[model samples]
Target chain A: MTETTLLTFLQWIDLVGVLFNAVLGAVIGRAARLDVVGLVVLAIMSGLGGGMIRDVMLQSGPPIAITDWRYITAALLGALIVMIVRVEGRLWDRIYPPIDALALGTWAAAGSLKTLEAGFGVLPALMLGTITAVGGGFVRDMVLRRIPGVLGGNTLYATAALAASLVAVGSWYLHVPTIGSIAATAVGAALVLLARWRRLSLPVG
Target chain B: MTETTLLTFLQWIDLVGVLFNAVLGAVIGRAARLDVVGLVVLAIMSGLGGGMIRDVMLQSGPPIAITDWRYITAALLGALIVMIVRVEGRLWDRIYPPIDALALGTWAAAGSLKTLEAGFGVLPALMLGTITAVGGGFVRDMVLRRIPGVLGGNTLYATAALAASLVAVGSWYLHVPTIGSIAATAVGAALVLLARWRRLSLPVG
Candidate 1:
């Protein structure tokens, strides 16, 4: 891709990710029966939440508080999309699991790769990877005054991020080619889906 | 303060801030009836939320993530404090709002002062001031899954930060005495209190 195309692609993906989360957030918020302000808050949390965590973990400082303002714009866009779309019914159910799965893998891959590019080591990269994939969504859920989705004993939320981070670490360790990382991430996400489909959990203390 | 003394004082104050937020977070998490892991997560969210936010807004990159793990240390310390203290009831209750207010004021003043020192204009400076004051708390509430305390129609959170920013900005502009900024900030906070008592609000769209 041309340089502009590359940048545009990344921005578009970011927007897509934000859009996905916004829709999910609104659905959750509606189920929670939150007010307008609450819905908006949840949408922002879902959209920018991971990036915020990634930024913090990367020592990049508050990304959204600065940046193109596009982050917030994307969040607002996502919120609007969800709000207008959800008035009818079931739009969220159509979107949630699959979009969440994609967001999980893509975000983890992006985070680990970006951290590596930023010259961090594998552990830091993985830490950031995990945070990126689940961090925003987690915060979004929590900020909506609910248990954070990732930690709420929900089906395999942070697990996807962890799987992706493992891929990042493994790729770094084996000095595998770039594509290996992506493949590993795909496998990890697929595993998350499997786990979710199986309702896999073991008793814990 | 002497350089060492100042650093120590700042760190001490920062520690106090961390502990304050930790207790507050634990209370909320416990009230929410979360598990230990959940409580830990909430504590982390509350403790570093503002400073991390100010860092992100400054685009300093993941404000707490870069250091050799100081943020983690702070988070743990805060959690430990809360854990040790929470054997009794309502300690967090007695401390929450007032400490939160102090944290907000400190961040707003400190952030605005830093922004002015960095040569930003008044608008950005004011904005930074507000973010610094409330950023962590906002993140805390968000992670706890509630509307941002700063943004929700509760206290005059943003107003206080704005007032401090104006003081910093006015001090920069007027070349006022060294303490003029402090005086202005006090006045601003007082105004916030007045607004709160009167149930005032910024104009809505």
Candidate 2:
């Protein structure tokens, strides 16, 4: 695919990721017995918070989550769907893992690309990419007064993000960012799925 | 005082706040039995996180924490002091509250003034101001797996920030931001002190 086409694809993935994460956030909020305001807050924060944090840290203009209308619309739609429908049990269990993994991959790729575009080095790109992938969940978990699962005892979520970021950065250095982004997403998502299947976890300190 | 003098004064307060917060963070880390690396991480985050969050959200330039040499130096010095000096017991108990309160006040004032200078309206100023005042402590609490004290059930820390921000914003409207900043700091610090003295707590939902 051409660069423009690849960029468009990444944007679409970012939007889809927002929608999925918003629904998941609402589900968690419901499980926590939160009120409607709390549910909406959680959904929006889980959908948009990571990107916001990344953009803010990049010192870029206002986050695209705020500048673009569609992002919030997608997140709100997700919240509405979760409030109206029962998105649980077997179907949710089967569907959530893959979608979540893909979201993480795409977000990491997008974050790394943006960091590179902003003229940062590889280390910053990798750090920001992982942060963009996991920051929303971190904020969500904090709001609920829980230890962030990615901090320890979970599958290799942060590591997968880091790997995806490294792949993207390497691709950027090789001057093939578009193809690298696609490869990074695939590698990241696959790693997440494999880790889950194998019950892989980093050892606790 | 002149605008230049006021600016200088605020900068000093900002630096002092970082030092105090870094020390506070190190104290907390010690209480948690964290290792040296963890203590340093907590100290830096507690010292600089709030201002960094505010500057990042402002999107005008790089965060002053990263750009300014003194901020990091102050934070590091704070960490070193706590690591070596055994900063607890009667001296800490007597000194901590007032210094902490003053830091909160100054941060809120600085945040609001900067927001207004960034051409944002009153609401953003208030929100960012409160975030600047409490964001570090909030992050510290989250990392420690505790609920942020400002969220609810504690003394009116967030409220004091809001009040200070409101005063600053109001002063900006009156075209006296320099004097307003000083007054806002005083009001915020006083409110915190009063809340503590009276053992006041917010109503929990």
Candidate 3:
């Protein structure tokens, strides 16, 4: 694909990731029995907080999510949808994990790419990428007064993000095409979903 | 005071504020029964997170705390102190609140001054100032899986910060001597301690 097309595709992925995280945040807010304001706050924070943190750390000026209206709008829409529809029962239970895995992978890839574009070194880029993927959820969990799933004894969340970020960063170093990064993201998401399905977890001390 | 002396005084206040907050953070970590690593992480984050966030938002590169090793060393010392000598009982409790209040006020003043120095408008300065003051405690509470003391119905913690920030920002705008800002911060801390002593709080809805 052309450069413009690739960029557009990447933007779409980023948007999708944001939306998914927003929905997940709203779901958690609902579980916490928070008010509407709380739900919306959590949604927006989860959707954009990580990227904002990363950008700030990168000294990249005001975060793009803040400067651009679309990201906020998307987060608001996702929150509204979740609040209005109230997706529950077995269906949501079955679908939530996969959607979350997809968000994790996409965000990790996008963050790594952005870091690379900023001309940072490999380790910082990879670390920032994982932070971007998990930071939002961490904020959400914190707001709800719970240990973050990534830090707690849960399925491999940060590990998957790290894997996806590594792929994206490695692809850049190897001079792979942009499309290769997307494939790597997909592989990462697949790994997360598979791990969840198999009930796999990293050993704890 | 001369400009050089005034600046030196302000820097000392800033250091004291960071150390106070770091001790409070370590105390909270111990209360949570966290390991030494968790204690140190919480201390550093509480001491530096707010300033880092403010600097990032202002597009100030590499947060001053990260550049100056003193802040990190102070935080480490605070954590180590808490880890080695367990402060408990009613006497420790009585002292903790006042120290925390002092930290809050100084941080609020410092953050507002920094924002003003960055040439931001008054409102952003005030908001960022309050954020910087309360942000470290917020992170600590979140990591411990408890509702943030500021967000929860408490003795006007964030309000005190805002009040201090307003005083600082207003002092700068009125061309009051820099020492006036220190007085304002003292007043802010006094108000918080008074509120706590009186069991005062903002009414919950």
Candidate 4:
């Protein structure tokens, strides 16, 4: 696919990721027994916080989450979905992992790619990418007065994002950013799934 | 003062706020028995987080914290001070309230003024201003797995910031933003000090 086509595809994935994360955030809010305002706040924060942070750091203009209407709409729709439907039990358990993994992978890929395009260095790209993948959940956890799971959990979420970022950055250097984005997403999703399946936890100091 | 002079003065106060908050953050880290890295992280987050959030939301240039060397330097200097001195006891107690009050006032004034200058509406200015005043401590508290003191407790921090923001915005409308900035700062500082002195706490819903 051409670069523009690749960007368009990624944009769609980004919206999907936003929707899924927003739903998850609202679900968390439900679990916490928050009011409607709290639920919506958590949904928006979880859906858009990471990308907003990345865009702000990149200094590349306003975050698309704010500039584009669709991002917020998607997030709100996710909140609406959770508010109306009782998404729980065995069916939710069956779908949650893949949805979360896809969100992580797509978000990481998009973040790293955007960083590279904005003329940032490899270190920043990696940092921003990992932040983009995990930042929403981190902020959500914090707002709930919980220690961010990403900081100390045995989960490989952050590590997987880092690896995906490396792959994307490597692809950029090879002059095949399009392929790199696709490959990075796949690698990130695969790794997260593998980690979850094996209960792979990083050793803590 | 002329507009430029007013800006320069606020810039100085802004740095002072960064220094004070960074020290406070490190103090909290020390209280938590955090390592050096944790201290530094908390210091930077508390020092710069609020303004960064405001600037990013404004969608203006890069955060002054990142573009200006003095901001980071001031924050690090705060960490250095905390690491070198055991800043607890009667002397620290006598000093902390005034220092914290000053930081909150200056930050709210700066944030509100900047928001108006950016051509945003009054509500955004107020919201951003409050975030500027209280966001650092909120983030720090979250990182420490504690509920933000601003959200509960009888403290009038957020309310004081709102008043400061209102003053600043009011001044802008009168074409006296310089006076507005100064007045806003004074109002914010005084309110915070009064709250602390009276042990005033807002009622939680």
Candidate 4, after superposition: displacement of residue B141 in Å? 2.7
lDDT of each: 0.65, 0.86, 0.79, 0.85
Steric clashes per prediction: 27, 0, 0, 1
lDDT of 4 at A138: 81
lDDT of 1 by residue, B63-169 (tens): 64334355556665665665566534476445555555555555566677667776677787888777766776676666665777567576677887788677767
lDDT of each residue in A1-205, candidate 1, tens digit only: 4556654654465567777777677767878888877788888887777877676557643465247677788778777876676443466556566666766776777777777777766656766777887877776655555667565456665666767777766765677525545564575568667768898642220
Q: What is the TM-score of chain B alone in each candidate?
A: 0.75, 0.97, 0.93, 0.96
Query: Between 3 and 4, whose lDDT is larger?
Result: 4
Could you list the CA RMSD of all candidates, in the order they appear?
Answer: 7.9, 6.4, 6.5, 6.5
- Per-residue alpha-carbon lDDT of model 3 for B2-93, expressed as tens digits? 87788788677677778778877888888888888998999998888888778777786668888999888888888887888776679878
In the order shown, the chain A TM-scores of the predictions are: 0.80, 0.97, 0.93, 0.96
Worst 10 residues of 4 chain A by lDDT: A146-155
- What are the runs in model 4 whose C-alpha is more than 4 Å off? A1-52, A59-137, A140-145, A149-205, B1-3, B33-37, B203-205
Considering only N, C-alpha and C atoms within 3 Å, which residue pairs clash in candidate 2?
none
Q: What is candidate 2's lDDT per residue for A1-205, written digit by digit as tens?
A: 6789888998898899999999999999999999878888999989999898888877867788999999999889889989899989999999889988988998999898898888776756876788788889878987888766665546677888888999999999999988998899998899889999999876422
**How does model 4 fare in lDDT?**
0.85
Residue-level lDDT of model 4, residues A1-205, one tens digit each, is 6789987997788798899899999999999999888889999999999998888787987889999999999999989989999978899888888878878988898898888888766766776788899889889988898766665443578778878889999999999888888888888888989989998775431
DockQ metric for all predictions: 0.15, 0.15, 0.16, 0.16
Best by DockQ: 3
lDDT score of residue B56 within candidate 4: 78
